[model samples]
Target: MLGYPIPANETQRLAALHQIKLLDTPDDPVFDRVTRLATRLLNVPIATVTLIDADRQWIKSRVGTDTRETTRKVAFCSHTIAEGAPLVVEDARQDPRFSANPFVDCENGIRFYAGIPIFSSEGYALGSLCVVDTQPRHLHEDELAALKDLTDILNDEIRLREHLTREQQRRAISQRELDALHRSLEEQIERRTRELNLVIESAYDAYISADENHRVLDWNRAAAAMFGWSRQEALGQSLQALIFPHGVPEYDDATPIEVNACRRDGRETPAEVRMKSLRVEGKHRYSLFLHDITERRQLEQLRDREAREDALTQLPNRRALDERLLDAMARARRLQQPLAVLFLDLDGFKAVNDDHGHAVGDELLRDIAKRLRHSVRETDYVARWAGDEFVIVLEGMAPEAIQGLSEKLILTIEAPIQLGEMSLYVSTSIGVASYTPASNETAQELLKRADVAMYEAKQAGKAQVKIAQQGKA
Candidate 1:
């Protein structure tokens, strides 16, 4: 047997062959039908459509054979492909090319061989469609022409198969690209949706959205908690019936209204509500947002009280006392009446604080405040001016009345305060100043005179009262 040299571009040729992606695939009836027809028309015992690869000759279709592949070097179709034409050995025993071939001497003896090269469109001889016989025979011109015609038919089939294979591959690649694009679009939509949800949740003002017929469509956490309703309970319910069964009467055709809404805990909370009508899915709906104003109203009331009362002792402080003193001065000037101011200071209160504790001294001061408040008329103002010092404003009072009230307050605060398991004694020095506003006396001048007189009383003795001279006023 003569050895045939492998082609120089054999590796590239095989690579190109495999690039068509047609190896080791399941059998197809179209190629099988063509091979069957070839065997019957040519009157051959064996026929095959063999595709030659790098290491093996694989049969794409075969008739009258169980084997699908054989070694490439020994395969007759391999030589036919290399020859690049039809190869015919009328008698294998007589032909030098195959005289010593194993097929000639084997039990399944081969005496005739004919093969037509299957050329690809690119002119690469891929394989062959071949017929073999065990009996020596010679082919007539008609028989040879018929075999060539069948080989042409085989070539057309291979071309059609290659076209279909390429088309199927293109379809698969296109489907993959479409799937990837769809996945990308879905991911973008999901990312945008999450960002929108985050913005809605973090908003400071509560926001809610609902479908038509007042059924809840969406509720944020702030909205849920603000109305004291859980998300689960609030969804898909009539907003008016759930929150405000009795509609706010203040909401006329033009004006939006505020109302008290009942919370989950049965507390009535003040809220300002605004509503608007909308259409969804061809039906009417309403959206409502409520703002709770309970804390704001309470703060306003507290501010009013703080404006007129002292923070420390809960009494009328200097600002309040000053206003009343000016009022008394106005009335005194108009009616030719007298007004008086009494200044009192707790004596040895600091010494008591240092000996005992500031807590006990604070209790003592509070007790003195109660006594001082009780000693004055309802019209008079008693206020803590500073630490351990108090001032009293007396309206429409003469000199004798001023002296009498000052003494009473002095005696009241000078009494001992009884603490638990302890007794604390404290004294006060009182000073009185009388003013007839018609005598060109101002409120400040009267206050200064009372301050000076209080110091004089302290010098005279503790627990005593002194009156300012008329010349000072």
Candidate 2:
């Protein structure tokens, strides 16, 4: 009651604990299995996975306990979390921290306890996996090691659950946005349809009316201008022949769709078309609206390209590199060809940033990216993996060719870069790792080998190449 331990980073630690979303949740078998294994392996009466909250220790999984939680001040796991390490109390009755505690002094009191702190991805102590014994007992070295390993497994599982929760929340937000957009679009269409004739003459979109037989009944000035025909010439013309010379696009309902619209000058324009069916004088008629969407489509394409490209260098980003790696590996496996990955790191990049400022450092990186791109064949995939780091995936290349390319890239990166008036010099350390069908290595494994080799190159000297030894799964 008098000696409550609190962590230095209590606030961040509590936030991380709640972010995992395991506190006060239903019992998960995955965690329960680990607790059960701990009880069996450690010969303990109770094994629990406990999360330390602001005022309570919530048990997420338990092997021998009906109680869900206990006050943090009285919980032994609290001390374990406070230490951020494994806490082993061989005899709680003799230990000063638990000698007067109710859980230790009460009938059938806890006498032995061992707990390993579980950490969050950001290195905050979230909780602990603990075992309790009614009789005082000492844990053997092997038992302590086993407990640590099981705690690591729990740490991974907790991180995975947190990641999945974040992904689900992200997807839910996107779905809600899509639904709102759909609703808004429908409302706009309905309102525009009600005020059609009032604004048709001045509206930017082309409006056309035709009978059920597809013969034009009315043509607005916008339609004539869009199709390069006068209203007098457009009226009474076959609607399909006037704009849809390539044939009308498929539009099942009032939803808008993109189609190729033919102009009188024989040019094709991308347009968004919306059709509405109406009955006038007991005769069926179709009203069409066409809006040119060329600029919209081009903007969308640019957005997609930016998503996969690095903004600074206009090179493929890490996301694009990952996709390319997977595709290249699949093709190599199918064709029984050799593939290689060249990992590059700019030497003394941090020094450049510190001495010349990030602006100049950025210019240097862009120059390096360009040089690396030019050094490799156009068929090779070059991507900016991260700041001052690049990855190049090459397929159907022999080991010797890959070696030559890596050396060339090193030399190419060593050249002076002119940033306005100042000429900056930097070199690259290159690592080459190859993969074949017989190697049975994953894309990540291959990249990791190359990265390790690059570090070796850096350790050996500033500007050099290191080839990675072939690795297996």
Candidate 3:
């Protein structure tokens, strides 16, 4: 069997591929969903997200096949990626490229294939999302378009996963480099003192050497610039007074540790500190390396917030809502207080989308999210449960107050949303389900009850509030 021709930029492409480190790992549901969707949409028996490795095609996700991998010579995905575009074969038996291939010549072999190249952010083709069928078939124009759309989604997930993986690798590398530097510096200080001084002067991070009593013995340029003091001013000063005026962390550990560091102006900054002990000319000293980590901390916070927020509405997503529900239930049980969950579903949202467009509908949903947010108190939690649906968790609310709050939310949503010249209107049906200490219901049950009540509100004409009558037994 003839193998697909290797790409001209195969070396660089493989380098980018290996850097993502996705090969032969555990199954990821994020990629699994893409393959599953591809099978259902394309009506294929086999669908896979495959990365073309040096010798094999590794399946990141697969549906309708037990084979996790196949040789690159027999992989249609290999050819698809090699072409750097979509490859569609109506009947593999009739296609010269794969007619003689064992995958097609064997009994009940693959007869149809459609694959789209998945590229890295650097424009290198890394792999492909391909669907396979046992029976010969041709794809309609819409089917091709849908397959492409699914591939786009797969590419997005790949990019996000790659980015997060690279960030983690970078942090690990920084720690390893610091550890190596610490060991090398200790050896250099023991054998050659003058060379150690030159190394500290050219170092990237702030370096300070202090005596056993915490008096600064040596201050590098980085240290002077970081703490707003010249080398002359920092030398002989108390290291604690210069950077740890408020408090000091245990600097006995040789490994890196995170700590709050004070600047000359008394401003605080988070830093990664690594300490090394040295004996110079029979004098005891400690060398400290400080690296500012404010940017890293901020990036971590942003990533955490993004994971818990809905991109469309900037509200707490379903994951966050579930956590909030569990916490609220726990507090209610401890305090012996009452809590309520209000499930809201927007009415006439579909009509608005169909009448105007998705853009208008999106703007309207954002407006509704804002109105719903402002309609409730800051103590209450609002989450976007799904499209056109929201869940609000309220703690320590009386029955009368819960009812009033639900009514207020409905009224607020009923108001016209002005999107430039056009005014859009939508109402919400609220379902109220309260939990008491005696009830002792799970979060899922509470949400189900509220959801059921919401349907009742819809049944009793939209824009009405319906309270769940039965509590958990």
> Across residues 189-299, which tens digit of lDDT does each residue of candidate 3 receive?
776877777788978789998998888888998888788989999989997789988655676665789988888998888889998888889988888999989899999
* Residue-level lDDT tens digits of model 1 in 390-452: 998887766766767777776777676889878788889988888866577777888888888
RMSD of every candidate to native, in Å, equals 10.2, 38.0, 39.9
Put down candidate 2 lDDT per residue, 8-79, tens digits, no spaces. 999999988887678878878899999999999998899999999999889899988887988898899899
Q: How many pairs collide in each candidate, listed in order?
A: 0, 0, 0
RMSD of 1: 10.2
The candidate that wins on TM-score is: 3
> lDDT of each model, Cα atoms only?
0.77, 0.89, 0.90
Per-prediction TM-score: 0.48, 0.55, 0.57
Candidate 2 displacement at residue 46 in angstroms: 99
> On a 0 to 1 TM-score scale, where does candidate 2 land against the true structure?
0.55
Candidate 1 residue spans exceeding 4 A from truth: 1-29, 36-43, 64-66, 93-97, 135-144, 225-230, 241-473
Q: Order of candidates by lDDT, top first?
A: 3, 2, 1
